[model samples]
Target: MTWLVTGGAGYIGAHVVRALAAAGIDPVVIDDLSSGHASFVPEGVPFVEGTILDQALVEDTLRTHGVEGVIHVAGFKYAGVSVQRPLHTYEQNVEGTRVVLAAMAAAGVTNIVFSSSAAVYGTPDVPLVTEDLPKRPASPYGESKLIGEWMLRDQGVATAGSSQPLRHTSLRYFNVVGSSDTSIYDSSPHNLFPLVFEALLAGNTPKIFGDDYDTPDGTNVRDYVHVGDIAAAHVVAAQRLAAGEQVEPAYNLGSQNGLSVREIMDAMARVTGIAFEPEISPRRPGDPDRIVATGELAARDLDWANRFSVDDMVRSGWEARRAAG
Candidate 1:
């Protein structure tokens, strides 16, 4: 009853892998080492160095390892960069999901936990978004993720008549930050935390894009959830699917309360005891003013609760970044 964790060497993926291992479940991993670190993967787990687009490799890994479930987390996730390279984003996120689904169908692995994003909800009229909100993705990355969720839903329907029907759960997360351990600090230069950390390390002020939004602090507000909580939700989602729980295809993993950019910086300063300055800049395209999730559905269905506060998230990220240095 092994699980196949795509991009298991990545920041959040590594945390999921660690969570699975801590629960005494040794899942097989397939990561290309594109933006993931090889050291992030634990020693005993069997790791395959490849991409999810490699259908043959994915099928082989699934079949050989007796993988009953899959947690897909391999994809490009930079909003600004996605706008510049829409085609690359589509290929990696949308087309890559197609390959993984095809392989799962071939290997008879029906259970899946998709890593979706809250970016799919672009500039919602409501303050706290629900699962039923209209998906109006602003960037190519968000569009690709929405398409990926559609793919899973379609696949699940197509396999319904089979003896072992496909069961899928897509967790739409918002602003996934922080670290579960110091060993797997974020390596991507695109995410906000790592970018700010790098800037501060270089003795420069972290830049804040858009200081005049409609929010209270005149900055964008986001629901920042800890990586460990997100990883725990994945585990619970997998268990529910495996237990034959008749649930929807997707759930939102987010903090019910939102945090503004200024709040985040304040938390960072408080956690690290460093007075950091921020350079104000104009808003980047495709960034919504406020995007937070209710996460009530996930709590009711998957029993997912975010235990780490915003301060905890910032402190853990600071600790991990400091250790990495």
Candidate 2:
């Protein structure tokens, strides 16, 4: 009856575990502690430290834990860096997913809630990206994620006649920020909130990648959802899948009402009381001017929404960052 959460010691995965715990559901964790902290796994929660690439270990963990479902969140998740390390990214995200799926099949665990990304849209033209948008992943990381979704879909097709055809859903999100748990902080060098917080904490000027983009502000505009909300949606999806209820193949957990980079800087100044302006830097290659998705479908199903405002998002991450310091 327990749910196995892969990468449950990582920031977002830890939040998902907390959400599942709050729902009175038992969560067993399988984390390799690659970028995750062992301490983040809740005290007394069943934890097995191993990579998803180990199919035997994954299968054993599922069988040993009597897991009814899995929330797969373990993978290499740096889109920008993936361009430079395509092979590593593919091995971790694609191959790791393959191993997890194989283990699930072997263990007869037929339900899974995948931790997906909006990077699959890859410079989408639509102002409001949706579940129906054609996936055109730009980087290897995004490509790997799309392939993971395909794996789930094809598996569902292949096992349709089985007693337990895999019931699964992938939640695609962009720019997850803020923190509900001060103990679990975002340490990703590639993420915006941590990058800015680190720069300010070091008494260095935070630099904006570009300020010449064609947006309301001079910088890019994208959906920045709170981590807590993201975790909540995952729990909801898992519950639905485990209940054998029909769910969409994929859902995008994003904000129709997103913020611009400049607007975020303004919030940072207000929240952290840091008055210095961010340094302007050259645009990173393949940087889009704006990329925000509408979560109407997720809202209908997963209780998704932008419950936290820009100020709330900024303050939450700032508080966690300061606490970590």
Candidate 3:
């Protein structure tokens, strides 16, 4: 059965598409091209360029492609930008997900793998967060995602008695970095990896937003997982759902290891052989001091393993960025 991958032409979405292709499954793509690149989509896979907000378009694509499952990844994803454009974030993330679910119910598609975020956990006092942690999003973007999850949960409950009920697995990710290929490396200016890479390419020092965090290095710490590994988890989730196995509404995907901002910078310097210092500033509002995940559930359930280290993530991103130049 074919799968529908929203935002399939984007960085993480493109990697998921590639993983699906590698598994000998040809998934169809629907993207509005607002943030995704057309070139990133693999050849021979059917692609429909449009917004998820367009319910008719989404339903038509699903029906035309005979899609049995969906991997939803289309949405606005910048945490800092979401603080400024709360309305836009809600519309794209929450409302857009609602539209997709409505279309899925209309088209009789039952299985889905949602791309959620660790931001839903907000700034918990605990260092390593688990799937069961309390969700208290600090930003509009995070709240939007939590709302999307609620939509799925509520919808699932409403359709429980239906012959074909919607079965979904929402994967909450923390700092998805690196690239599946050079053509689809992150184009967003907001993410740390891309921002630093762009600054270094322009012969400028990358700026660190905060240096007074309680972390050991006096910088923010995050769980940086490889994009390829994230893609693999989606694949496994899709397969499990299709196999008629019982699945939960959400799971956390992360490295289970925290990497400090300074550590990332040092790794980049080591990989690219460039010696440059980052300009430190006060911590941005809504920014968490540390956000790491306990990915044990994903590892046990999906057989997911992060093969790339911090150095590998940096070097792969460097290669992809240089190739894009």
lDDT of 1 by residue, 1-325 (tens): 6899999989999999988877666788999998898899999899999988899999999999999899999999887799999999998999999999999989989899999998888778888899999999888988999999999999888888988688998999877899989887987787788888888788888889989999999999989899999998888888888888877778888788889999998887777777977789989876778888988989988778889887899889888989987
Q: What is the C-alpha lDDT of each candidate?
A: 0.88, 0.92, 0.90
- Model 2 C-alpha lDDT per residue in residues 251-273, reported as the tens digit of each score: 99989977899998889888999
**Each candidate: RMSD to true structure?**
1.3, 0.9, 1.2
Model 3 misses residue 256 by how many Å? 1.3
> What is the RMSD, in Å, between candidate 3 and the native fold over all Cα?
1.2
Please give, for residues 1-325, the per-residue lDDT of candidate 3 as tens digits: 7899999989999999999988877799999999999998988989999999999999999999889899999999998899999999999999999999999999999988999999898888888898898999989999999999999898888888989888988999888888768777988878889999988888999878899888898998999999989999999999998888877688888777889999999998899999998888777876778888988888888877889989999988888888987
At residue 241, candidate 3 shows an lDDT of 89
lDDT, candidate 3, equals 0.90
Candidate no. 2 TM-score? 0.98
Off by over 4 Å in 2: none
User: Which candidate leads the pack in lDDT?
Assistant: 2
Instruction: Give candidate 3's TM-score.
Output: 0.97
Instruction: Please report, as a residue range, the 10-residue window in candidate 1 with the lowest summed lDDT.
Output: 19-28
- Give the worst 10-residue stretch by lDDT in candidate 3: 279-288
Superposed Cα deviation of residue 172, candidate 1 (Å): 0.3
